[model samples]
Target chain A: MKKLNYGIIIILGIISFIPLLWVFITSFSPGNQVIKGGFPFWVSNPTLENYVKAWETAPFIQYYFNTFVIVFGVLIVQLITITLAAYAFARLNFKGKHVLFILFLLQLMIQPEILLFPNYQVISQLGLVNTKLAVMMPYWASAFGVFLMRQTFKQVPYDLDEASRIDGCKWYQTLWHVYIPSAKPTYIAFALVSVSHHWSNFMWPLIITDSVDSRPLTVGLALFAQSYETGAQWGMVAAGTVMVIMPLVIAFFIFQKQFVSSFMHSGIK
Target chain B: MAAKRKKFGSSSRHNLFAYGLLFPSFIFLTLFTFYPTLKSFQLSFYSGPMTRLQFSGMDQYKEVFSDEIFRKVILNNILFMIGTVPTSLFLAMYLAIWLNKKMAGSSLLRTSFFYPTIIPLIAVANIWLFIYTPQYGLLDNFLHLFGRGDTSWLGNPNTVMIAMIFMIIWKDTGFYMIFYLAGLQNLPRDVYEAAEIEGAKPFQMFRHITFPLLMPTTLFVMIVAITNSFKNVDHLYIMTKGGPDNASNLLLYHIYEAAFTNWDLGKAAVLTVVLIVIMLSITAFNYLYLDRKIHY
Candidate 1:
């Protein structure tokens, strides 16, 4: 039974590994070899030519920059907004709190991504289309962040809150010194989730931005790969795919424990 | 009387402070979410460019409902959901259960499955697109061993949905597996010990004890999966562009085509309304179910 269990898991694991393995292998294989493909297990004459050509083909450096700006822009704004909002919801006895909380929940239900058409209109009217701000703006107030942080903040010892208040700390100061410090794990988890999400976000960015100045790696990769549909440039495409995924995948491997637990933290509570 | 008056005054101060704290989030929520949703609803009732003023009540909705492509798109979304969600759920649960036991190389096994979850869907779509490419693609090359080599998986209408479904199942199963892993960790060990003492078979223990105890996680994960079916159409953009005669078109991608590609804002508005309704209902069901589960 144990052997059978191992056999099943290892087989499934290989199945899981194949696409990634193939992409990695194909990225190094020559164009002729790829064209001569038959179960691309061996790269007899491996080269970095595909990576060079892919880097030269698209302005990936610019894409990396735009992605960084947008991802961090969204995260910084979200951290502030969610922190204050979560504090209010968790600690304050405000009027209409339930109704207001429900309003926030509405964002969770009807995510900004799904409101693409209307959101595009808003960005256009604000004259922010084709800009990183447009990509960053809609996600600034993350309801998911607020919801997750509220759960964390609520668990903070009430005595700490009282003590902070007794020390003549203003509400914001108390939040900074007490609530934020106590909810460090939640902050890390939410930041990981948010950063990874915005890094991977595509459709809305695809619609909103038309220039390389604002297009992230995913959009750039899509445009680059789509052009190769009629041309069998698999090696370059694979290289580009690898480049786009490598950073996050590497970060994930390095912080695999943190990444797994962060995801679990997002879901379980 | 003085103390009572002081309490009342301080409570109002607290209210103001709370509102001050919530002010930033509310501004953004109103702008990008609430207003746009309301705008979509309003636009669905009218039929003209953004500047033109005309009210054609229900005409947009009627047109969208009557449109052939819209029906195909909605049906494709349904089929994609039915295809990916349950299968991924079962696979995820099975993998989680097996890996939960103490075993050598389990960490490696876990990483192999979960790594895909972190990769961007667009990148995933690109990788899978190559895998599904015709003749010289990895899939065909692999199948050449079995004497089946020539197939345009994404180019044929008959096979396109299945092709997209299989790719999605690969991309998402690992993600859903993590949730099941988390759920498995939280299940009481004593119940399983008790079930073993009672001589219950492994399958029986799973069918009764583990599955029943993991009901809340199942429901939560189910909600995430259903919503994902609607939200995640990035693959469609790369794999087929909802092609092979719209065989694999989903609602969100359809809306993208209507709104951006075709610049048919009115039709897109109606589609948006339809999507919003679907999303709202799913989340509503989730909240209601989760609310009930909380009490248990």
Candidate 2:
């Protein structure tokens, strides 16, 4: 039975790894070798030419810049908005709290991705189209972030809040010293999830941004790959694909445990 | 009277502070979520371009429902959901059960299964696009070993859905596995030991004990997987573009085409409303299930 379990896992593992492995291989193989291919599994002569050509073929530097600005830009704002909103939901009492909370939940369901058309209109009307801010704006208020943080904040002992209040700390001060510090793990978890999410986000960005100035790696890679379709530049496409995924993939490997647990935390919450 | 007024004033101040804290989130949420949703509802009733509008109640909705492409897209979306969600869930649970045990190389197995989850769907599409390409593609190259001829998997309507479904399962199975692994860790061990003493088989223990206990996790995973089915259409943008006569088209992709490609704001509005309705119903179902799970 133990042997059989190992066998099953080994086979499935190989299956999962095949595409990634093949793509990695294709990215390294020479352009001529790829064009001459019948599944070129190994490279007799590997080269960095594809990567060079892929970089030249598109303004990948600008795409990388745009992606970083958008991902962190969205995360920084989300951290603030979600923190404040989550604190209110977790601690304070206010009028229409129930109704407002339900309204917040509506964002969780009607995510901005599905609201592409209407959101585009909003962005256009606000004269923010074709800007990184356009991609970042709709996501500034993340319902999932608020929901996650609220769950964490609610777990803080009531005594802490009272103690801070007795010390003459204002509500925000209490939140800063008491709630935020204790909820460090939740903050990390939310940041990890949010960063990875916005890093890979495509459709809305694809729709809103027109030029390379604001297009993230995903959109840039898509257009770059599509441009090479008739030419069959699989090697360059693979190279561009690798460049787009490498940062997240490498970070994921380094932070494997954190990434796994963060996702798990999100699920459980 | 002085003390009561002080307490009342403090309570009101608390309310004001709370509202101030929530105001920022509400501003963005109202702009992006609430306003867009209400706009979609209103626009669905109007049948023209953005510049000129004539309110024609329910006409856009009726037209969208009757359109062949819209119906096809809905069916395809449902089919994609049916194909991807359960298969991935089952694989996830099965893999999680094995990995949950103490074994060497388990971390490797975990990484193998979970790595694809982090790779952007767009990149996954690019990788799989090469694999599905005819003649020189990986799958075809492998098939040649078994004497099969070259085939265009994505180009053929009959094969496109299955091809797409298989890629999606490969991409998502490990993701769902993490949740099940978490669920498995929280399961009581004593019950399994009790079942073992009674001479219950592994399958029987799973069916009778583990399955029953993990019901909440399964429900939660199901909601995520189902919503994912609606949301993740980036692959369609890369591979099929709802091609082969719109065989693999999905509702969100259809909405994209309606709104952007066709430049039909009215139709797009109607489609968006339909998507919203579908999403809200799923949330309603999830809440009902979650409420029940709390008592259970």
Candidate 3:
């Protein structure tokens, strides 16, 4: 039974990895060899031509810059907003605090896609359409972050807060010195979740950004593939897909423990 | 300073500070989350102009319900959910249990399963778009080894959703497995030991012990899966674009098409209203039925 379990897990792992392995191999393989695909996994003649072609085909440099700006911009703002809000909910006693937190919970059920029309209207009204700011604006505050932080903050011992406060710390000082450090795990978890989310986010960026100037990597990659110009260029598409996913994929490799632990922690939350 | 610190908990000044801290979040939440949700509902019943909405007394909702595309989208969403949610849930549980033991290369296997969840669905779909490409794609190429040839996976209305569901399950099951693993590890071991002492078979132990204890996690995963069913449409854009007569078109994709492609914000508002109502009912179900029962 134990051997069988191991076999099942190994099989599942192979099934999941096969597509990933193929994409990686195909990205390096020459276009002709990919079409021939009788060779198992490895290419007899791998080339960097597809990567070069994909790069020249799309403004990948600009897309990468825009993606960085939008992703970090949203994350920076969200950290501030979520920390402050979560602190209030976790530490402060106030009128309607519970109600306000409930409101935040209610937002969880309301997927952002449902608000696409109105958010677009708001962004356009602010004259921010077709810009990276427009792409980042709607997601600047995250309810999930607030919820996760609040839960983590509550788990923090009150003694820490009192210790900091008795040391002549301001209320914010207590949060900064005490709550923040104690909730560092939660912050890491939230940051990972948030970063990956915005990194891979396509629809909002696709809808908001019109040009290559503001288009993030996902939108840029989709258009790069589906422009019908490169529609049949499988190798190039594989290369572009690799370029887009490489950072996140590589990050997963380096921080494999943190990444998995973060998901587990947040999921259990 | 000691007195001041002690007074910090309930003082009116602390209340003021708390509100100050909350102000930034509330403002953005009001602008993006609360306001847009309320605005969507209001705009759903309004028509005639974008600048000035006139209350048209259910006309927009009526039209949205009558929309053939809307019907197709809702049907597609149901099919997508039915195809994905239970299958992924069980697969996640199965993998989590099998991988839970301390074994050689176990962590490596877990990472392999989860690797897809880290990549963007759009990028994954782009690779899959080629995989499903009619004659020369990977799947067809693999199938030819078995004497099968030339299937148009995404281009066909019949197979598009299945192709999509397969990719999606592959993408999600690993992530969900982590959740179930957490749940499984948290379960008390003594119950399992007692079950074993009573000569309980593995399936019997799972049926009575593991399954019941994992109910909370199941409910949580179910909520997440249902939400993902509606939320994830990135692949739809990259792979099929709700194509071949809108067979694979889901609700959010239709909303994107109606609002963006057709520039029909009024109809989009109507669809948004439908989405919110469905979301609300799900929330209600979770709170009323599932929340009370969850052991946590």
Candidate 4:
């Protein structure tokens, strides 16, 4: 029975890796023969020319920089906002707090797509359209982040708050020194989830930003593939794809244990 | 007593400061998120292009109902939800159960499954596009090996939606499986031990013990999965663009094309309102139906 279980797991693992392996192999295959499937696993003349073309065909450096700016900028703002919002919801006593909290939760219910038109209107009205800010604006306040932080904050003891207060530490200090420190795991969890989300976010960024100047990696690759219309140069496409996913993939590998555990912790919570 | 009064004063001030810190995010939510939602509903009454916006008073809504494309988009959304959600949830649950056992390299397997979830959907869509090619793609090659003719998976209107659904399931099941795995890990082992001692069959143990305990996780997963199905536009945008006679055009993709491609923001806003209404109703149903069943 145990051996059978291991056998099943091995099979599932291989099945999961098939697409990934396909992409990895195709990325290195000679440009001319990349699309032929009879030799899916064999790269007759592996070359780095595809990677060079992929890099030259677009300003991938600019794409990466734009994506980095958006992801990190949005994450920093979200961490601050979600922390405070979560604290207020979790610990504070105020009028209509429950009702307001429910209203906040309602954001999760409304699909982000539904808000695209109106959000675009708002961004364009703000004169922020075609800028990285337009891509980052709508995501500044994540309902999920708020909810997660609130749950994490609530798990922290009120005694800590009282003790900090007794020592004459102010509320902000208490939060900064005690709550934030204690909730490090949750913060890490939220960070991983948020960074990954923004890294892969495409549709909103696609709509909000018009040109390559503000375009992120995903949109860059998309436009590349779309323009290569005669036939998708599979080698370049695969190489570009590998470039796009490498950061997150490498991050995942380095912190594989934390990534898995964080999901487990956040999921259970 | 003086110190106590000073402390009380400081506490009130601190509370106000906390509220002040929260004010920006609250304002952001009201303006960008909630306000747009309200504006969408208001704009749903208008007709004509965005620049020529004029209130037509339910004409747009009426048009939405009459529009064949809108109907097809809605039907496609429903079909997508039906096709992807159950398959994803079931596969997740099954995989979670399998991984919960003490097996060698389970963590590695979990990571392998989840790696796809983190990759950009457009990138995956590109790879799958190649894989689905009629002549030289992997699927066709595999079919040839089985003595079957090459199939135009994405090109055919009949198979496009199915192809999209399959890709979605492939990408999402592992993510959902993590949730199920977390839920499984949280379940008390003693209950399972008791069932085992009673010589309960594996099916019986799962049916009686595991499924009941997984209700909350299931509910959460269901809500997320359903909403994701409704909101997913990337795959369609990259792979189909609602092509082959609009076979795979989803509601969200339709809204995107309407607003950006057609420059009909007024109609797009109406579609947005309709999409929100559909999604919120599902959320309400989830809350009404499943929330009560959650153990906590």
In the order shown, the candidates' Cα RMSDs to the true structure are 1.3, 1.3, 2.8, 2.6
Give the alpha carbon lDDT tens digit for every residue of B1-296 in model 3: 88877787548776787789889888877888888888888888888768777889799888888988888889999999999999999999999988888888889999999999999999898878877877677788788889997998887889998999999999999999999988988899999999999999999999999999999999999998998998889998877789889999999889999899888878888888788888888889988988997855
TM for candidate 4 is 0.95
True-vs-predicted CA distance for residue B183, candidate 2, Å: 0.3
How far is B171's C-alpha from truth in model 2 (Å)?
0.9
Best by lDDT: 2
Which residue pairs overlap in candidate 3's backbone?
A: none
Instruction: Write model 2 residue lDDT over B1-296, tens digit each, in one string.
Output: 99999999998998888899999999999999999999999999998767889999988888888998888999999999999999999999989999999888899989999999999999999999999988788998889899999999999999999999999999999999999999999999899999999999988998999988888888889999999999999999999999989999999999899889999999999999999999999999889767576556
**Ranking of all predicted structures according to lDDT, beginning with the best and ending with the worst:** 2, 1, 3, 4
- TM-score (chain A only) for the predictions, listed in order: 0.98, 0.97, 0.94, 0.94
lDDT of 3 by residue, A1-269 (tens): 86887787788888889888888988888767755657648888888999999999899999999999988999999999999999888878887787887888877888565677788888887899999988987777788888889888999898888888888998778877888888888888888988998999988888888998999999999888887424346778889999999999999999988998898877765
Highest DockQ: give the candidate number. 1
Answer with 1 or 3, whichever has the higher TM-score. 1
- Output the worst ten-in-a-row residue range by lDDT, candidate 1 chain A: A32-41
- State the DockQ of every prediction: 0.86, 0.83, 0.71, 0.63
Clashes by residue pair, model 2: none
lDDT, candidate 4, at B267: 80
Positional deviation of A258 in candidate 1, in angstroms? 0.4
What lDDT score goes with residue B52 in model 2?
A: 88
lDDT per model vs. reference: 0.90, 0.92, 0.86, 0.84
Worst 10 residues of 2 chain A by lDDT: A31-40
Kindly list the per-residue Cα lDDT of model 1 for residues A141-169, writing each as its tens digit: 98999999999999999999999899999
